[model samples]
Target: MELSQNKRVADMNYFELIAWLGIGSSHPGGFPATKQNLAVLQILPDEYVLDAGCGSGLTACYLAKTIGCKVMGIDINSQMIEKARTRAEKEGVSHLVEFNIANVYDLPFPDNKFDIVIGESITVFLDKVKVYREFFRVLKPEGRIADLEMALLKELPVNLRHQMEDCFGAGTNPLSFEEWHNCLAEAGFQDVEIKNPQALKDNGNIVMNELKKDWVLIKDLTNKIKRQPTLLPRLQKNAGFMKRNRSYFGFGLIYGRKPTPVKLGFKDWVRQVIFRKKTNSSK
Candidate 1:
């Protein structure tokens, strides 16, 4: 199908947007808590961190309060950034964290400023190539990026795949392993580690135990959407193309670092998921 205008987070409610955006992140460990989500990515108390596509900044704020470290969070939507900042301040982490309204491709910082960068299911919403290059430019050498984003295992059943393909359109990006590697390599990240953070892990059952109610709701909704199919996409406000490919998509995850002294698991593949970053320099 043809790609046109990009989709916005407001295409749906904040919570629902986050839900759809975080594919394959079954939160094995409960939503944010279930997967330990960003929490699993430990932080150093004195290091400076950048959080790209910080959404509500829950992870950013938590990073600051938990580590007492300096963190700068940025996102394209001004309103979301504002809400994130307010929450940070209310939680008393504002002293160590700052939120900004900006796009991932045009970060406002000097090169090599952040010790670590994170995108908690945020990269799926950005232009992967340009954003990865930007991250390479702004991060401190050897800095790591962690994210829980949707990855591709393989194509789902055609009907499901096509339905998803239509509903998401260009908004949905599915990448093979090789494609992901080339992109990261071209962007200058070495020792890249791209594997299923939850691969074959039965943690989904544990997660389902918690979100069971939501699971039932989503399943019922899923079946309901399949029947009409167009209904959910329309309700989600997806345009024509997105609605056309609603079911043609699936998800998984990725993580990597800037040129670091580590093992190289190099390979050629198409990539879909991404993790974004920010720095100490204020916008």
Candidate 2:
């Protein structure tokens, strides 16, 4: 899926703009935060991992290459899936990683298929509990979900909130850390907690830091900017918003695990039957 040359950045949605630019890490705190969360996940090589809303396959390919895990990366955007497949091939992790164009709301996989599901900056733009419910459905018993997302440090003023929606998208709704935890819990995730919480810092430095780490974004950035003159201003607009309102935002890993189903032994099952019979008689 090619971006139309005549299309203006202002006319494009936030996802479209990032896909056009091929930004590998367009989340809060960028790749550094991803790495920080990855360290805590301690994924095993044999684990079957799902990278939900994977952009450009940076994190998925890295997981396959570094941890030797088998990863399935899915994004609703065809352009992102294309880029991710290319990245997997280029990084020689094609055998370990796969990319597909699929919606997170309706994952194609069967229930209890994945050992871990990782998402970066994707849930903020959607219904948090609804998205987490989908994540919970596909995860194996006791499977883990590590979603790195922006958190509201404090209550956002109405004016700043409007500016944020303009910069990101109208649906961009970041929750407080507690709210994030609740969303996971509501989705039936046990041990719900926010890990590695930190306040937003200088946007410029974060961009530079991520650029230095992400060669894929750097390699094609010049050509993209040259093709779309509005790109710089669009980037500046979003960055300026974050830079000005840094205090109201932070990011963390919204971590949780699906509960394992309990099994009953024969003795326990018989006792349960007798108890149920007595309760029915009493009633």
Candidate 3:
């Protein structure tokens, strides 16, 4: 690997990755009520928590230190994982937390393994359906899933969707609000519920305000996407609508749980196989 000029490489995947979350709500439709929302899910000592896509691993360290629980953090970015591990050591929670490099699409664990699974703003990086299915596989009975995702209130305009590539830098996978519910339901999650960021105005403002400096970058990217004939129309139409009414009908912070094994059908097996990817790796 080569050295980076910055603390992290400006690669699409790691660009502003840790800084955004570590600094506070860098995600679009950012964390709604942050700690309060996370508290509702509840994490206690002795629990085995999985922090998927744990970017810089700060959250995992927090879980380990604060809750006195063992936290396993996984991400596809090895550099991110390495940084997380070093941070854990610096914070002196290295023993309670383990950081690893792994793909969400291919989790290296068995059925019914985790007590809690928390994914914060990492959903955009994955195939959602596949991740949810895999989420089910590794979760223990009644295991909780807390997700911080950006959900569109309506279909994104072509312009916005086209610029998604630029905004994310890394390839991003997006799903509408309905798509999130359907996928969670399809994954055998029970008592699924969702909360929108707009519903929590103060938090939304905090997120947008923290991102003021980013406005220039966002504006530039939008302008670039707007000039492209193939993309301008949708951004003008679909994505524009969300941006305009984001204060009202923007993004959502959702949480769900995997229920105990339910009666299965032939089709169910197929669904499981679709999301399940066998991997031979370890913490």
Candidate 4:
């Protein structure tokens, strides 16, 4: 899958291509897994949810329809936000879901604003620690955060690792299964559960099937190429890379609970002050 001579993979990132393609459920397990995660969330109709990287807003609409809850979706990509807004309108859940162009690192909402936060394969493309911290800050006490993210089954060779990182785009440095757990723990999440790790090597077939169901997949992709002809070659190159290095990558679904704030009793406060004094003395 050689790209045209004039275009390089560096010219366009993989996420831009996905945004242009307008693919829904653009993760490893697709929508089925998305539905499963939503089901287990046990959402109450009265609760408010955040879809952190709601690409096309499919999950947002689904959440609204399934639980009749309010869903606010935020994405950094303006183009994706526009498409997501249109999808929400089309699904007749525009009133139930709001789409905004916003960064995950600094969410526009105030602290403790949401009952639940959900993301699908989004954390892999950001500063995971910072983004998780933001997710933690915005969630109410005992609120849950759930995500489906890419994970490396094993370490790749140095050259292969560099190549994959460069080509995968949007900071797509996937963590190992254990690393993800530690990341969540460090971000102030307790009871972290990383589960259902699946091999991504043969998952291209799943992605293709989902895209095939979209009658306008080619149409949207062609429109993207017309707008920026150089993107075609870069997209082809990404495809080639994925086909070649699929074996090293996989996906994981994660869930974590934000601990409820506890009131400190006299003994607990004394212990904390002593601990703080000892920490400062050591420093």
Candidate 5:
């Protein structure tokens, strides 16, 4: 199924391509960054963890194996869910990690079931406020949330933002670091922290290193692109733009906690009403 109608290239299945290329940890800082952020979660062995938008199940498998926690990995793409299931079996963690095809905006689980809800490179493609609210709804009280998302180092010009949206396809909204903090806070999360604020350019070489490790797949793709010449120049153009504007793109690992609901005062209620209006206007 098509991931989005806004995706420019009809033939390109982004998630499938990533899985086929065997790029296990395709996020900003890869598995090492994942480990770093997850460390602060303090997940116990008996915990139930929700891996929202869990692509390929790599991180979920790691959590199951290391922490021995029960994890449920959900992705909207059925192909990704299949791959995740296969990956879990291969990693001998299927017993601990389960894969499901579901939407993030409406999670299948009941309220207050999970001890932790975590996602890597996932939230940028979603309705952040809606998804975060869903996460908050399903999380146990004081449950931890760990999310790594793409962020804009600084605001971009209109043309540049359009260029990025075209290159990355639809659902490419990225918030600034402060915006992210405010978003989490507004979503009922407390003690929100943006950690390890490294520029995307700083990790260029690391991504290159991953590309080198998957050179064989790259070679195969190069040949396939040769057969379909239409795809090559578009890919090249996007790559070139990314290289040119690397400094503007960055990612952040954010952590927050689910706090007990407090009655809002008149001022707080008015601020929330205004914030919701502004959010709708931005959309």
Candidate 6:
């Protein structure tokens, strides 16, 4: 995707900047954290997975390659979807992984279509319950959701909150771990829990560390920074804020499962039938 030369990187929002740079892992804790969460998911080969907000298709392709699961990845950004498709093709996972441009709130799939739904660093920037409910809608009975997101480890002061919005974007709200768990539960999920929770670590070179593993992306990012010199400073500003206020933030896997439908035995079914008949007759 060709970024507009007229648009300054300074003016681009956080998502746009990352998309333009083609950064594979922009979430808190980066790709290592993703690997940790994947260990906990224990995905099966036959399961169908949905990678919600899958930027550049890193995690989606990884799932297809590592676990042999069929994955459908969705992103709101066209550039992200395009890059993701390219990554899938390059990584030889194109047969098992697919990418599409779609909104998380209104997924294009039918209800109960996916065995698992995964998200990273996306829900923090949107309505958590609304997104979780949509995820719940598309998940099959007993399906799982594993969302990796930034969480508030402590109360954020009013000034820091404002600064956070300035650095990321408006409406960037990271909830406490308890609140994250409750959101999934409110969305009709069972066994909701925040797994592998930990406070933020200020690895000063997080972006470099992740990108160094992908030399192709590193070259692309270098070209991007060359084209838009303002990009680095803008990224650094956000990084600085995170490092300075790292104490107030943390991240983890917000995991949950859709409830399985109750099965009725023969006697219970007979009682229900008789009760329904009586109630109908009375009416």
lDDT of 4 by residue, 44-152 (tens): 9999999998887888888998889999999877777877888778778888999998889989999999998999988987889899999999999999888899888
- Please tell me which model should have the higher lDDT, number 1 or number 2: 2
Tens digits of per-residue lDDT, candidate 1, 5-111, equal 24443354433443332222232233544235445556788888888877656667767876799999987765557667767877888889999877788899998
Write one digit per residue (lDDT tens) for candidate 6, span 1-283.
Answer: 3468678988888777777777768889999999999999999999999999998888999999999999999999888888898889888999999999999999999999999999999999999999999999999999999999999999999999999999889989999999999999999999999999999998875665667786447767777777778877887898899999999999999999999889999999999999999999999
Positional deviation of residue 79's Cα in model 6 after best superposition, in angstroms = 0.5
As for lDDT, the candidate ahead, 1 or 4, is 4
Model 5 pairs whose backbones collide: none
CA lDDT, candidate 2, residue 84: 89
Report residue 269 deviation for candidate 2 (angstroms). 8.4
Superpose all Cα atoms of candidate 5 onto the true structure and report the RMSD in Å to 1 decimal.
7.0
Tell me the lDDT of model 2 at 178: 96
Model 3 scores a C-alpha lDDT of: 0.64
Tell me model 6's lDDT, rounded to 2 decimals.
0.90
TM-score of every prediction relative to native:
0.62, 0.91, 0.68, 0.84, 0.79, 0.91
Reference-based lDDT, residue 75, model 1: 73
Q: Comparing candidate 1 with candidate 6, which one achieves the higher TM-score?
A: 6
Sort every candidate by lDDT, greatest first. Answer: 6, 2, 4, 5, 3, 1
Residue-level lDDT tens digits of model 5 in 129-174: 8888899989999897888987888888899988877766567788
Ranking by TM-score: 6, 2, 4, 5, 3, 1
**C-alpha-based local distance difference test score of model 4:** 0.79
* Model 4 residue 174 distance off true place after TM-score fit, in angstroms: 0.6
Report lDDT (Cα) of residue 58, candidate 5.
75
